[model samples]
Target: MQVDSKAIDKFLVELLTEVGTRLREDSIKKMSVATKKNRNDLVTNFDKKTEQFINGEIKQAYPDATIVSEEGYGDLVKDMSGLVFFVDPIDGTMNFVKRGDNFASMIAAYIDGEPLNGAIIDVMDNEIYHGGKEIGLFINDRKIDNPKNLPLVEGLVDVSAPMALANKFAVQDVIKKSSGFRVYGSAGIIFGHLLTGKEVMYMSYLAPWDLAAGRVMCEAAGMSVVSIDDAPINMLESQVVIVGTQKVVSEALKTLKTR
Candidate 1:
């Protein structure tokens, strides 16, 4: 059965718009914060509440669809066989808890293990980057052109802070090949820059929700989405996600191997 792309996109836009507005409004007040894996890795009340709200909405709309969310509200999805919605209600929870900016809400829908549609809402900027297999990438209802295929040496690359700090996967070498490096602390926002051509490439160790939605948008915009080792991404697990033009990906991989 072919899913209705237009209908899915419309529903997602409405859902994400509401999520973004609520998150922005909530940021002004004090939030309850707690740690998950470690002290530096934090989660706020809004993250749990937002994920619950989104999960409820997804269930109401499509009960059969399985949700794999960052928060504990989703199911333990073993595979991406049927309808699966990956949700990152707050991609940058630390940023939301501290800076209250540079965070984003991302959701991607996959059917039969294939990306069907994806949406990333830049809450601070009131901009939405969304697209699917049927409809191309769009920002706030306007169709945007594909980003230029700039080389690694010509443009800035966004790297995860931890990756750069630890020199993981010889990312520092790849950074030197670029004009410079940027650490946004949020995969969704970094992906936004990659889609708009503000950053030529982005590489990080990311979870499924972190890269799921952005993967759809990046591929739709004529960009490359692959592992740092030059392999296809596994949508159900964490991996080193690298997104950029072909030239940049090739160059970055070569640099990592040589290092």
Candidate 2:
């Protein structure tokens, strides 16, 4: 089935905006939280509710779309075959529960294993970063400038906290080579920075929902999206995501090789 990019973009914006509004409203109230895989990995009432709302809306809007979501509110997708929607209702659940500012709501629509539309809403910041292969990258109404091809040493880089702490995949060495390092808990926010060239590179182990939206946005904006080892990213599985300008990617690969 051919996708109407315009309609999908509009629907994405509306869906994300609604989710963001509810997130803001919920932030002021107390939340019910529980541990997922570990104590650090959390799930809140907001996350579950937001996901259920988004999934329900998607089903109503596009009945045939398969939704792959966090919190298990979506389908048991076995392959990236049809129209698949990857959703993370709250990208930074920890931040949403503890700080309520850095979290984001993200969704990406893919057709036949290729990303067609993507949107990430920084709920508290009132920023909506969205775009795809057909529609160009945009922050709300404005189309964003393509990120510069800056090398690692010349620009700031963002890494996952665990990767930085353990120095996994030579992450620490890459940071030392870069101008500096930043650790944002949300991959969506980190990808937002990369989309606008605020940071030269972002490296982390990410799930499908975590990377799906950002991958589309980054690729649409002429940035690189690949594994830390410079391999093709598997959209349906967790992997080490390395996204940035070409130069930054090259520098990062060099640093990783040296370690």
Q: What's the lDDT for residue 46 in model 2?
A: 66
Q: Write the residue-wise lDDT of candidate 1 on 80-177 in tens digits.
A: 88899999999987887778799999999999889889999999998899987689889888998888999999999998888888888888989998
TM-scores, each model vs. reference = 0.93, 0.93
RMSD of each: 3.0, 3.0
lDDT (Cα, tens digit) per residue for candidate 2, span 1-259 = 7888779999999999999888888776544434434333334666888899999999999999999998899999999888999999989887877787888999999999987999999999989999897988899989888888888888999988988898887678889988998888899898889988889998888999999999988888888888876668888789988899888887788778423
True-vs-predicted CA distance for residue 110, candidate 2, Å: 0.8
- lDDT of candidate 1? 0.87
Ten residues in sequence with the least summed lDDT for candidate 2: 33-42
lDDT of 2 at 236: 75
lDDT of 2: 0.87
